[model samples]
Target chain A: MTETRISRRFAECAAAGRPALVTFVTAGDPDLETSFEILKALPKAGADVVELGMPFSDPMADGPAIQAAGQRALHGGQTLAKTLDMVRRFREIDAATPIVLMGYYNPIYVFGSERFVVAAKAAGVDGLIIVDLPPEADDELCLPALAAGLNFIRLATPTTDDARLPAVLANTSGFVYYVSITGITGSATPNATRVAEAVGRIKRHTALPVAVGFGVRDAATAAAIGRDADGVVVGSALVAAIAASLDADGRATAKTVPAVAALVGDLASGVRTARVGAR
Target chain B: MNTTPNSLRNGPDDRGFFGIYGGRFVAETLMPLILELEQAYEDARNDPSFKAELANLSTHYAGRPSALYYAERLTEWCREKTGGKFGAEIWFKREELNHTGSHKINNCLGQILLARRMGKTRIIAETGAGQHGVASATVSARFGLPCMVYMGAVDVERQKPNVFRMKLLGAEVTPVTSGAGTLKDAMNEALRDWVTNVENTYYLIGTAAGPHPYPAMVRDFQSVIGTETKEQFFAAKGRLPDAIVACIGGGSNAIGLFHPFLDDPSVAICGVEAGGHGIDVENGHAASMTGGRPGVLHGNRTYLLQDGDGQILEGHSISAGLDYPGVGPEHSWLRDTGRVTYVPATDKEALDAFQICSRLEGIIPALEPSHALAQVLKMAPTMDKSKSIVMCLSGRGDKDVFSVAGHLGETM
Candidate 1:
């Protein structure tokens, strides 16, 4: 397979002798304009790769924080077309940072999977992480996406046993996202020891880089998890930051973008120092 | 309609697609557990002892083989409406007479037994109007296991009696307040619970929906309704009825009654959807097949009420039980294949049928099945007098009397 932006970014991070800091923020959150500012500021604040959440009305896999972010975005009239446009705008300024669109499959299915891939590739999306479409339903979007040159990133959870690991990794590209916990996002604290073991186990199965996410909040946890994994992903915490900085009316205030950027800077510093004193 | 050589009963191919409708569309964390459930269910299906235990429970515990009664008064009223020119003889598969006052108990019993066989200790379920919640709590109590039922807060307030019934049965009722606080929201909360507690929890889905094994498995368990209806209708009328009708929420009762008659070319199958006001009213009905299109939600690709962005829309219905955005994937497949006809019954029509049936036949039907009864009232008057129709009285109205009274402007 040819190397894409995601692969090249991971390679760059590895060459720097540190894990990458992956930050997730819902697109069009608080409003389309503020969300774009946050997206553009992520890489500068040390987010190596960005996961843009396409807010859906029902985000079953999401916990309370991300769910609220999605609702806020939708209440502000965020549509799939608008989300894609936000990506297009983000790509205009930044061409180096890899961007992955993460959400459920229905919106993409409604958008026409073939059309979505073409449009997504044109809009500068590097990969996808559709939580609901497992390996069993690969024909729905995974293959078409791979054929269109967009990386199809797959999530490996704690419940994915060794027997089922191969199928989950069969068509996966970009990087393998190892969910640190068995529950929904931001529900539980992932034990660093177990996450490292899981990352090692996944590494034994494939040559792709492994990124650990779910329940990652502070820089300490990020650094702990980044010690063994190739990348550290933080989503619910960043979304929670946006929620906290919002005004009483739930509209975006002056602090929303800077609040998320500050958190991302801290998490990036954590990842940069993850391997400094350990080995 | 010519009967094809192929059997309609056989479906949900090896990968669980009922002709591009049903597939396992869940998170990877739940994938292994679902596969485990499929295997355990397959093993139990082939084991004779499993069938024997389920049969025993159905016969003695759930009061199975619920009577198939001829609605003579209802039929006479239809004849009066048509001025004796046309009226099909009407019969009812009395599932409301079952233990929990609905066909929900039949599926509950089968699933609970399977849960025990799989060594699952905790039980979780999602309910709309609490009929399924009551049934799930009943089985959990009978088996000495703890149960948790997720219900929309709106339904909790509206269906107070059934909520109390569930509480009395030692079940925890969690009121979900998100997304209009209705059935779809309750289902989303239940999925969250299942994902969080996959180690020992068994999600006893109330309807014939959800992902792969669930749609097919729930249908197999509920198929007992059709299997019994076939024999009883044959015994009472000496042949099959001209048609059969049932209401569709998640389509459990309808599929239960229609599965056995799928290949019976002589028996026409019709499903009634809950049209809150009318199909044309914006976001005012739960008629997925009538006013919606196919989209993925709640782990299955089915007909759903979604917006232009594929965001699921909150559906409205006077009967809280029928308020859901999506229909079962099997029903979607059936609709596509033209194996069954689907129609909509407005809340006004259902309310009218509820009162007419209560006064004439002395059987107060639940609002869910009243939709089916409304469709029956419309169709019976149009058919020839010699023809016959059987409708599944899926639930009793004792639980709905309070809501019905409020709707009728009565203080009670």
Candidate 2:
């Protein structure tokens, strides 16, 4: 596999004093058009990385807000093809930002594991974050992803202590996504000091840049966590914010994208400020 | 709401919904398999050769066309109750008449057959009540395939008889110790086994959940219930029943009974979920669709019992079969689409129905089915006198006799 256009930019963004800004939005949200806009707009709005959520009917790693968002996307005719197409459109517009498609692994597996990788690479997907795939079955994704020059990002939770970290890292490419809590996504409370402590521990094992996610909601939380992490991954909060801008049926009735974009811009500033403060 | 096209033949449609309940809510991991299954099931179900093969197996191997006797005395007793699953045109699918003594044989047989076509030899399953395990074991034996079953440690103790039956049928039962040490744990273990053995093994999931194709496929096999009921009801009454009802666990049996008649707008479909104590408090309930959020579990995202922080919550119910944290993805889609209405039944009500049906009808139902009976009894009597209701009696009560004996004030 070759380096994705996005993953390389992520490294560049991390090299600067500015912390990486990773934004997650479910594809086919409200509708496929909005999903495309969200995907295309993230990079311009100060987001160095974007996790395009493949709308799953069941999202175990998401809160109600994200789950509802996924359901809305699915209902609005978002399929694996459409999600990849959205990524392709983003690739056409911006070739620098890292685009990672995040969701459970079953949908991808259902969509033709081999075909998915080929199409994903063609659509300009830089990395993937499958919540349920274990390192034991890395061949289901990792090998194919690597073959396509795509990065297979691994999630290491608090449970992935010393014994598991190395194996997870060995199979993982791109960067390591550190789960800040003992439980599933959207469960952990933001504890910056504790997260920073954990980040220091992870830094010793793998040279891979570590990003802490799960409870990085507000700018303060993202900034605090950014002090130790190479990147701060905020998902549920962004989905929650986008959820508010939607009508009951999940349509964006106004210029909510600009508001969402501004929020990301502000959060990006916080990450950079935190990096500076840490220095 | 009843607009989802009803397929008289089995298999998932293009959209994967078993008449608006079953659809693909999977990640990218299993898309190919789901798509392959849809095509395989569609082709096989339509082919005369395949139909004949399955019919022969059901008739000779698993014993199809189970009896539909009228529980006269039970109907009279239900005459005073609110609803009527045992009364009216109600007919037990007589799934217990099968080899493993449950309707699970229908699904296991279909899946094993499908696996054979896919050239998969090994079979892996997750069992709670052990009914599905026993069925899977029987199918693997009939097909001469290896079998593995994951059971919750707690379930292994309470359902020891079924565990023994499974082993006797040549299936290895592995006790799982994750999560709540119950159905959810078993499910996780099964998923681990599948992911580890993806090449030569087929995960024969027992419920109508887990990623794509499963929720739809399980219903396809179980759709024999709806097909049989539709034919039998018309034969008995010269018309279809006004309503059809069943207990929903992973919504498999309910979907099975509802799929055939889904296109009939005049017919209503009702599903009963495990409501634990009652509906007032969502606490301690296994009613995923009623009191759960959408979350992924056991390879598929669906309605799940989760906490404020999105941690999946283990559910509670008197019946081991109903004690699951999440539902099949199809059920979540169905709830969202308003195609089928899901109601909650408390453990007490199920227990009450268990004892009442046994004493009144001389036929005991499994605790899971008793939940459906509870709902049927709740509102049947209030229905129009001319209107008739048919509840799919998924399985017999023999296996449940032990579990409910204690709750029914009978010594085990």
Best by lDDT: 1
lDDT tens per residue, model 1, A1-279:
698899999999999999999999998898999999999999999999999999999999999999999999999999889988998988889998999999999999999999999999999999999999999999999999999999999999999999999999999999999999988998898999999999999999999999999999999999899999999999999999999999899988999999999999999999988999887
The CAPRI-style docking tier of model 2 reads incorrect
Residue-level lDDT of model 1, residues B1-412, one tens digit each, is 2335498877888888889898999999999999999999999889999999999999999999999999999999999998999999999999999999999999999899999999999999999999999999999999999999999999999999999999999999999998899999999999999999999999999999998799988998898889899999888878999999999999999999999899989999999999998999999999999999999999999999999999999999999989999999999999999999999999999999999999999999999999999999999999999999999999999999999999999997
lDDT of 2: 0.75
Chain B TM-score of candidate number 1 = 0.98
TM-score of the second chain in candidate 2? 0.89
Pairs clashing within candidate 1: none
Docking class of 1: high
* lDDT by residue for model 2 (B297-330), tens: 5655577786543445677888888888777765
| Per-residue alpha-carbon lDDT of candidate 2 for residues A133-238, written as tens digits (9 for 90 to 100) | 7565576678998888788898876556676667767878888888786444455576888888888888889777788887777788888888888888887777
- The TM-score between candidate 2 and the true structure equals 0.62
Q: Retained native contacts per candidate, as fractions?
A: 0.82, 0.01
